[model samples]
Target: MSGNSVPGQGAAPRRSPEALPPRSKLAITASRVTAAISRRAGKGSGSVIGGKLALRLAPDLLAQLSVGLQVVLISGTNGKTTTTRLVAEAMRAAGPVVSNALGANMPAGITSALAGAGDEARYGVIEVDEKYLAGVARDSDPVAIALLNLSRDQLDRAAETRMLAEKWREGLRGRDAIVVANADDPLIVWAASSSKDVLWVAAGQTWQEDSWSCPQCGGVMQRPGDDWFCSQCDFRRPSPTWSLAGDQMVDPDGRIWPLHLQLPGRANRANAVTAAAIASLFGVPVEAALERMKHVTAVAGRYDVVDYMGRKLRLLLAKNPAGWVETFSLINPPPTPVILSVNALDADGKDTSWIWDVDFTQLAGRPLFVLGQRRLDLAVRLEVAGLQFQVFETAAQAVAACPPGQIEVIANYTAFQQLRKTIKEAAQA
Candidate 1:
């Protein structure tokens, strides 16, 4: 497979948790099953295999559809899902759309997402996995692609963020695709340089003041004291056509409409900025897009909020270092209680090493509850970081121990799923 292609790209979705079909009959079985499931699920197209089954599918299927899709691919170390969903929403405002809203970014996943997009749909919005972006780019040359900020992520299957950026540069070379990039991110900006029609979106002026020092020259980057600048060297920051300004931004229209933030973390502001910028570039008026953002709600498990009797539960899915850092940035000390969970599955990256790179120091004064299959490991890390936390062997034990009202459960992908299932089951009981 090309660095950008999804291996066994088409056949993988036939076998499922629900039932099994013979291997020899996989293609015919999948074709029938997906069509039936898609209709039953009311999801637009066939329901292909989930993970492994998807890998077994044929690539020629994707090649046939590639010619007609106006794919919008979103990739980053963080916030790609949320930002992609937002951009997709904005695009849908103009017309219909098909996307993998469930955080599936691989070739098989992308194929499954597109299956329902319909033969007539004009646009496809996909939040692609960074490692898989190049492959998908090769298969389907999306019309507009947005590269959000890159940070430390899965170190097992994917290379380091810089290496992934380089792969993107190579894979996307010569593709007639419009690129939107995060100018504040040194890595993303560099990768985007190879692409045409890049709309550089800056986070804001006040925010870049402390962090804008050039990683290249070691010199203080020039600052208009409003946005970022670099006067001493050839390297300079782009003045973004779009700005989130800062945390203190007012609603463009009114004050009564509170900005509903579904995602936790001050860093999510960057995600919001990227989403808004992408939406703007997609022809959504900046004001209308910002207004839509005010009503934005979280996708399940990704900072989704739930009520427990009287207590408030905020569920955050922290799958990698960047995710953890983003969640921790939203943690306020002294009173708010946080329950953190970790998992060690290979898909989530088996190496517990990335935890060391996380800013565990942020928890110094925060009350924390720890759980997951790897609870003990996380507990030790927290203790070593000088943060106090209660450890639980199971999610149930952790939830039982949490105080009622306004609790945040920060967990990795598996832990989040287990916790969500347990929480829902408990609610039902």
Candidate 2:
């Protein structure tokens, strides 16, 4: 820590939870009952139902459960689940950590995590929904907040990226939390611009389209070098205290450390760097934090390779254009038959127009087996893009239609969960 300067300027004062409300007995009882009922009814996770009940019984459930614990809240459009997992792993040396393992990120889900937290836990790493960050941040009283890139996702229910950025900026102003933000994303940069005690991490931003315009001046941004700047205003990417130099991470003092992650892709590596940066703020050894993250194989089924009806299929989730772009870059292209699944459910975003934002033309003349509720919509997009694709009414049919090779399955929210459930249950049986 002395050599790296990690515990100096960029580091924030350690804030152990104090003066918080005590654990709510009523909330705990309600949560337990709700969880039991949900589990008995075969509902997955039972986190949300339990959390809703817990919060209903005790509106300040998170504030109560978070007493005497250091909370690190992670919020973003993508990678929240995976980042939270990595953060939790790194935060272990600080103390026992309670995290949202079910990938339920709303207030209800966070309440559920708090309800189930071990009494011995000293830290709570909660994945927060971007829209609910302000309120949740206040409730959890996070010592450190990770603001990953905000993107155009769940358009039916989610605010535009720019609006969301402003909301974050407003919510975080003068807050006691030390914010760790992605400087590469204009939206993320703008969101934390007004925040105090912000430590910037140059975590790569894959979705440039969403942040091409300056959030402050509304002018087109120019990316001259490694940094981006607004042409008409002072808004620009902050000089990152921590940044990725290929697989290596450069800390505040300009010392480089290699990032080794078991999870695939630049995105996961970027996520690891952010978590490591946060851990360093909490006095966790950088090497020790990275070592712990290497053991994490999958996160809430995002990159889990499961037996899909006896055939090996690597499960990948892509909820929006940004997520899809990163997911596409992670895997090999062509000939490898992929099950392209999409759904327009409430969880998947009722509006499917965001599909047009993706550069599906890259897959032109390549083989793609499309399925799910929005498969037909995808077919049209594929057809217009002059891509070679086969549409199947079911995932099983699509899997069968693929060429005989290692299969990669990409699905949206509900479709991905449905596939994960089926494969997991089959494996258990």
The numbered model that scores best in TM-score is 2
TM-score of candidate 1 on Cα atoms, chains taken together: 0.79
lDDT of 1 by residue, 1-429 (tens): 112121222322222212323432354346557657766875433444532244365444443444555678899776777877777766666556778887777777676666444545656788888888888877776767788777655666668655676788777777767777777766676677777567776653212222345544556666564545455677666656555545633322323222345555456666666666566545666556656665667774676778654567888788777667667766556577888989988667777787876778877765788888788889888888988889878766666677654787788887787777777777888
lDDT of 2 by residue, 238-342 (tens): 888888878888888788888778799999989998999999987988889989999999988788877776688999999999999898887667777777899
Those runs of model 2 whose alpha carbons end farther than 4 Å from true positions after fitting are 1-23
What's model 1's overall lDDT?
A: 0.65
Give the distance in Å from residue 114's predicted Cα in candidate 2 to where it truly belongs. Answer: 0.6
lDDT of 2 at 206: 70
| Candidate 2 local Cα displacement, residue 163, angstroms | 1.0
lDDT of 2 at 297: 95
Pairs clashing within candidate 2 = none
lDDT of 2 at 151: 87
lDDT score, candidate 2, position 217: 81
